[model samples]
Target: MWQNKFETRLELEPRPSRYLLIYQIVLHTLAGAALLLPLILPAGVAFVLLATAGGSLLWQVWRHYREGRGTTRLIWRTDGAWDYQIGVQYWPDLSLLPSTYITRGLIILHLQPVKGRRLYRVLLPDSLPKEQWHLLWLRLRYAGFSEEDVGVKG
Candidate 1:
């Protein structure tokens, strides 16, 4: 209970990250190219595969981010509870799993709802202002992944 208590609540508004979109596109494109550079597949086969993969990736990205699809709200409670909201849907019992990866530039929140499927939310430096981003990173590091909190060793 000691760790859960805090002076003020922390809430964040996460927006779509163009950096992540660009990163995914370039990474996927390079992977597709690499699959062919070794000549594992015939030239014709590789071209077809690469084009198909690239096209699908673009479509998926467009759909996920169109019309502010990636924008969401996150509330961090003093009792160490989290609430997630997107559009008109809200999940009050969404738990932040320990597998989350956080850095100064990025955060991948592995979240699970009490009654629904698990999901991962991407938080990027550009998602918030510099000060808020820093505060979020600090809270995640100390409250979310602290050794005394999550009981992860090594």
Candidate 2:
């Protein structure tokens, strides 16, 4: 769309990650088992307390996951600014930190504002179609490696 423009902004819309879903299921199942482990271990107040603690933790994680933590739509500008949409909320104008990690199999975007908690979005291999993923990966790598980011330096 911006073939005539100097700088290109990127928008990557990846479908929900099945790998992430699987990971979440397995991880939570293991945690739930751990929470129930006390039942099989023995009968004691301490064991019950331990199980309760684990259950509480599991509940918190599950709640967080259910509340808009899966699948992201990311928009990155050439000026090191970015935004993302999680679930139905669009988080805008977050600064993209240089700490972002990009690799062949995965990509992690480190997004944060001037005063707020840091946020991260992880992109797995299956996040997008093969060709799209390849192109996106190339663009990310290129952007990260570019010194000036824009052609004309001010």
> Which is the leading candidate under TM-score?
1
CA RMSD for every model? 3.5, 7.3
TM-score of each: 0.77, 0.60
Candidate 2 local lDDT, 1-154, one digit each (tens): 1122117776777765667767766765676666565454555764676666667667755754664356568887666577888777778878766566777887776778667888888788887788778876776666454533322111
Off by over 4 Å in 1: 1-3, 35-40, 67-71, 148-154
Give per-residue lDDT, candidate 2, residue 114: 62
Error in Å for residue 101 of model 2: 2.1
After TM-score superposition, what is the CA distance of residue 131 in candidate 1 from its true location, in Å? 1.4
Best-fitting candidate, scored by lDDT: 1
Q: Candidate 1 on 1-154: residue-level lDDT in tens?
A: 2245567878888777778777888888887868767786688888888888888788869865673654578887777767888887788866777777776677887778878888778778887778888887877777545655443322
What is the clash count for each candidate, in the order shown?
A: 0, 0
lDDT over C-alpha atoms for residue 14 of model 2? 75
TM-score of model 1 (CA atoms): 0.77
